[model samples]
Target: MPPDALALYATVILLLPMACFFLSSPTFLLVGLEIPEVTQLLRGLFNGYFIVMCVAGVASAVAYVISGRPVFAVGALAVAAVAVMARRWFLQHMDVELQARAAGEAAAVPRLRALHLKGMLLNGILLATVIANVPLVV
Candidate 1:
């Protein structure tokens, strides 16, 4: 397969989950996080997102390298690195916040909501970046 095609497919893999979450996340807002299931579901969704992004990013990096686009390869690697760090940070903080909410702290729900919003915002930025740079790569 052509390197450009490889990159395109790899990016599509990355974008698929991102677009899912981007659309689904706001729907989560339609419901409240006060429900235990909703919080856990959101948490699980984000965990999955991070994992998928790591795989997709590496795939994209390999594609970029094969295409002789080393700089884009580096960007892809950075995306993977960011996902790795963000995963750890998110899981840790999520656990603490979950515990706090479990313990009846008033602020925990809002914090979770903030995390949700931040994730959405970050995902949007990444999606925009990928599309924005497609002209250069393809």
Candidate 2:
């Protein structure tokens, strides 16, 4: 692919997840929904978001490789790995903690909150990484 096309792909890969993050975040509370409902909605939204991230990551990696940018390719692959880990481990742990909290295990509440915060931090880092790379990739 041409360099411009590759840059466009990279931009899409980075921006789409950011958009999803904003849409599913605590700001959803402004719509007047209950906390549990927002949590449930975000959980479902993230299921799709993770899949999107995985696809976008792979596509970005391939684009980078085609554009002769091996470092960017590796970074994209790392993003994909993180996406998989977030989906498999972090999300599952959050679900388990949520269930435990529902079962009256008070300790699970803090753990769940921590997991959410970690996820937010991870997203922030990922976004920053993409932003930092955008100029070089373009």
Candidate 3:
């Protein structure tokens, strides 16, 4: 396979979760987060997002290295690193909020929403950063 093709696949992999989030997030606004099933679905979505981000980042890094773009490789690695750190932090905080909510805390649901929004915000930033690098790869 060609280097460019590999890079394209990597980029697509990285962007896919963001694309899904764009469609999935607004629906969260309509649902009651207090529902156990809703919280479960939301948590699953977040878990998958982070997992994909980690995999895509590493794939992109490998693609960059194969394509002889070591600087971009470093950037890709950074993306993966961020995903790794963010996943641990995000999930931990989320679990805390979920537990609190289960325990009948009034503020827990709102706090979870806030965390969701922050994750979405980070997604936007990452998407923009990845797109910005596309031209250089081209």
Candidate 4:
């Protein structure tokens, strides 16, 4: 396979989370004044998280099938599971944030930072796993 194909695949997988993140924001989702259910409230959180996971899963599956690397599949599955768990944790923390806000407290920045950090971590893990599976083309 050509190097360009592999690079494009990797780029697609890496950009998926960012796409989801952008969609999750109200400012990013406004086509009109009214916001749809998918981009509103808790549903946005769930949708964004799950869609990102699904994108990553499908992307990694394609890469694994193309590259003939089962390790990529395993890494993708790990990433999906971690994403789900992290989503749950995010909801819990978001609840805390809401409570704090209701009590006249400011929102914490670490929560947002952690979300981006998690995405980076997943990307790093997937990249390393895929690179490790590169076969010699003798």
Candidate 5:
């Protein structure tokens, strides 16, 4: 795929889990795996959330196609939904981590911070790309 399309795919993939991660669980799939157990489990648990994201994307794409213009809004909403949910979840988790830090569990704080940054960066990029594509429209 071209870099643009690849980025779009990445955005879609990120959204679903992000939403679910916030609403329910932190489990997710990494690129590589020993047994793929964690990945499979997370995917299984959040499958409905993923479906909702994809459906939202497709619906937005349909509207864009009908209008004969690119609307990054579709992608943007998807990303935002995910980010909102993920952030909510992250904040909740962060509270726990904060307490742990107070208790001198420094190790978990760094790891959680890393994960938070990673999620924020990824979602931010996805949202930006969606907006950038608006002029090009679909």
Candidate 6:
């Protein structure tokens, strides 16, 4: 691909996750409000967000590689891996805890909250990493 095209691709890839991060941040904060219906809706939204992250990460890595920037490709792949981990492990466990809490297991509430906090922290880190890579890749 031409240099200009590659730059555009890189910019789009970077922007995808940045957009997702900004949009999802508010939902993360609202997780603590303890509205079951809203929480359920947010859970579905987060699932979509994580999937988008993974796809965008892979796309960014591939674009970087095609653009002859292997280091940026690796960084992008790392961000994708983090998203996969959050989706497969953190989110999965959070769902389990939520179910348990719903079943009247009071102890699960704190655990669920902790997991939510961890998810938010991970998301912040991922957003920062992606933002930092934008200039390097683009």
Which candidate, 1 or 6, has the higher TM-score?
Answer: 1
Better of 2 and 4 by lDDT: 2
TM-score of each: 0.93, 0.82, 0.92, 0.49, 0.41, 0.80
**TM-score of predicted model 6?**
0.80
Q: Model 4, 9-110: lDDT tens per residue?
A: 654574466454544443433332122332235435554755587568667666755666555556566666766776677666655644554455543434
Better model by TM-score, 1 or 4? 1
Measured with C-alpha atoms, the lDDT of residue 94 in candidate 3 is 91
Cα displacement (angstroms), candidate 1, residue 55, comes to 0.5
Instruction: State the C-alpha lDDT per candidate.
Output: 0.84, 0.74, 0.85, 0.52, 0.49, 0.72
lDDT, candidate 6, 1-138, per-residue tens: 685478568757756665765676566565562557766766676677788888888887888788877787787788788778778886688688778878888787677667666766777777776667566654
**Which residue pairs in candidate 5 collide?**
70-137, 70-138
Q: Which stretches of candidate 4 lie above 4 Å from their native place?
A: 1-11, 18-50, 62-67, 106-138
Residue 48, candidate 4: alpha-carbon lDDT: 72
Our tally of clashes for model 5 stands at 2
**lDDT of model 5 at residue 66?**
43
Name the 10 consecutive residues with the lowest summed lDDT in model 1.
6-15
- Model 1 over residues 1-138: C-alpha lDDT tens digits? 887887777667667777887888788788888788999999998898889889888988887788778998898888888888988888888888899999999999999999888888888998898878877777
Cα-based lDDT at residue 76, candidate 4: 64
Once fitted onto the true fold, the runs of candidate 3 whose alpha carbons sit more than 4 angstroms away are none
Candidate 6: list runs displaced more than 4 Å. Answer: 31-33
What does candidate 2's lDDT look like per residue over 25-129, in tens digits? 656435422255766776676677678888888888888788778788888888888888888887798688778877788787567666666766777788887
For candidate 6, the 10 contiguous residues with the lowest summed lDDT are 25-34
**Looking at candidate 4, what is the lDDT of residue 2?**
67
